[model samples]
Target: MAKLTKKQKEAHAKIDKSKSYDLAAASSLVKEITNVKFDASVDIAIRLGVDPRKANQMVRGVVTLPHGTGKDVKVLALVTPDKEAEAKEAGADYVGLDEYLQKIKNGWTDVDVIITLPSVMGKLGPLGRILGPRGLMPNPKTGTVTMDVAKAVQEVKAGKIDFKVDKTGIVHAAIGKVSFDAEKIAENAKEILQTVIKLKPTTAKGTYLRSIHISSTMSPAVIVDVKTV
Candidate 1:
């Protein structure tokens, strides 16, 4: 195999892209981190048919990352009367009732993710329906339903983003950036693929995965050879 060039070595070192500084020496670091220049998270988003730019919904679900997501995520909970403390103890950022629904209605649309309990579903289900059409509903079949309050909070805080196959039979989500270490993003990608595989609907026919394309948060999409993933 050919030896990696000095430029390549320097590029690999830029994988630790902390926002503190955009080191001039690391100009090619993002490209070097991997043989690609796309956002792994955004790439994952595209494969699932999610047009991040125009996505009007927030399809919620969960997946246990065998290799773990490389980034941190904020977690929020929507609980009823008795579940507030449980949600807090579980490390939820904010726990409340239906009142907070307005936040979603208003312009506080930074809900990167959410998870809810089953008992509260009946009450919140319809509310979630509003977000569902916008791809913001938290459905269990997509890994959104859970009775475990702590699990929901922890996964979100730990960067466990949720994505569900849309009506078109595809799921999209952000895993990480291509500027991220290939190994890191690749690991997360594997975890996501495995989860999607498990979510395969027994009722469906033909190819389980129509296709998968990887890209950056602001870049063109690239098809990955994930025949094994």
Candidate 2:
């Protein structure tokens, strides 16, 4: 194993591995432990009891963070010419259809979120291989594929994010940046956590939320008590 650097060691030393912290305490501690020069993203990892393999137990949904994700979300509006103006007016960074489709075909997915009209989805189907793995495929369930281009673009720019449970039953999402106040981080974390709780599947047995952890891009994970969440 690679030896930990002094900063990494110091970050690990600040937390007690045996104890789980409340959301507020974990949020504050994560900021304190992050030593990266740039503003690191604060992420929360939640392990749920549900099995992603089961259709009924699969958990996936969207939530708008109380404080917008500190990162500026670059949105691509893949819409017809008629909706181009609306998408642009809604603050989409890239607005177009065929030209952008060709760009993606040539492996240029430079944007964060892709919003497109329902009519445009058929054209996108052929490019699923390129977009699916990158989590860029706009799906109706997540409100990414819709007729209301402006609303979709605005929501994405305003901190709306979609998350799905991985095969291992863990849901990982970036809540905010380390530069944000602890309160903002805590609130963002709460927003996602509460949303996840509400999405608990009826088929899921036992504890829905198994374990929760909060950390920054480069910091050690801080265990968050499931009870306190």
Candidate 3:
């Protein structure tokens, strides 16, 4: 195993492995432990009790963070000419159809989110291989594929994000940057937790939220008490 750096060791020292902290305490502690010079992204990982291998147990949904993700999201709007103005007015970084599609086909996915009209989905089917793996593929369930291009683009720009439970039954999402206040981080974390709770599958028998942890990039994970959250 690689030896921990001085900062890494100090961060780990602050966390008590045997104890689970309340949401608010964990949020505050995460900020204190992060020693990176740059504004590192704060992330939360929730381990659920569902078996993701079973179709009925799959969990996936979207939530708009109370405090917008500190990162300025870049959005690419692929729409017909008529809807181009609407998309642009809604704050889409890149707006167009054929040209953007051609660029994507040429392996250029430089944007954070992609919003497109329902009619344009068919054309995007062929590029699924490229976007799917990158988690950039627009899906109707997440409100990315729709006729109201402006609404979709605006929502994404305003901190909307989608998350899905992985095969290992863990849902990981970036909540905010370390630069945000602890209260802001707690609020964002609560928003995601509540949304996931509401999406609990009926087939999920045992404990719904198995474990929750919050941390910043390169910082030790802070265990959060699910009971308190």
Candidate 4:
């Protein structure tokens, strides 16, 4: 095993492995333990008791963080000429139909989020192999496929994010940056937790939220008490 650095050792010593902290305490501890040169992203990982393989137990939804995510989200609006101006006005980083589509066909998906109209989804069907795995495929359920391309682009830029449970039954997401105040981090975490709770599949049995952890890039994970959240 690799030896821990002085900073890593100090961070590890501050966390009690045997204890689970409340949401607020965990949120504060996350910032304290973060030791990185760059402004690291504050991430939350929640393990849920659900069989993701079962269609009925699939958990996926969208939530807008109370305070915007500290990172500047890159948005790609794949729309026709009629909606090009509106998409650009709404701050989409890339707005075009054919050129962007051609780029995507050539294995280029450089944007974070993709928003397109329902009418345009048919054209994207053939590119599913490239986009689906990256979670960049626009879906109506996630509000990424809609006639209001501008609204979707604006929402994404404003911190609206969609999350889905992975095959391991863990939903991981970045809540904010370490530079954000502890309260802001807590708020963003709470918002996502509440949204996840609301989306609990009726087919799921046992404890829905099995465990929760908060951490930053390269920081030790802080355990959070699910009940207190």
Where does model 1 exceed 4 Å of error? 1-42, 45-61, 66-72, 105-108, 201-206
lDDT of 3 by residue, 36-147 (tens): 9999999999999999999999999999999988989999999999999999999999999999899999999999999888899999999999999999999999999999
Clashing pairs in 4: none
Q: Which window of 10 residues has the lowest lDDT sum in candidate 3?
A: 149-158
Instruction: Estimate the TM-score of every prediction.
Output: 0.63, 0.99, 0.98, 0.99
After superposition on all CA atoms, how large is the RMSD of candidate 1? 9.8
Candidate 1 lDDT over residue span 115-216, tens digit each? 677776776554654666665566676455688777677666666666655665457766665555556665666677777676555444456555665545
Residue 157, candidate 3: C-alpha displacement in angstroms: 0.9
Tell me the number of clashing residue pairs for each predicted model.
Answer: 16, 0, 0, 0
Q: Could you give me the TM-score of model 2 versus the true structure? A: 0.99
Kindly provide the TM-score of model 1 when superposed on the true structure, using C-alpha atoms: 0.63
The residue-level lDDT of candidate 2 at 201 comes to 97
Residue 84 deviation, candidate 2, in Å? 0.7
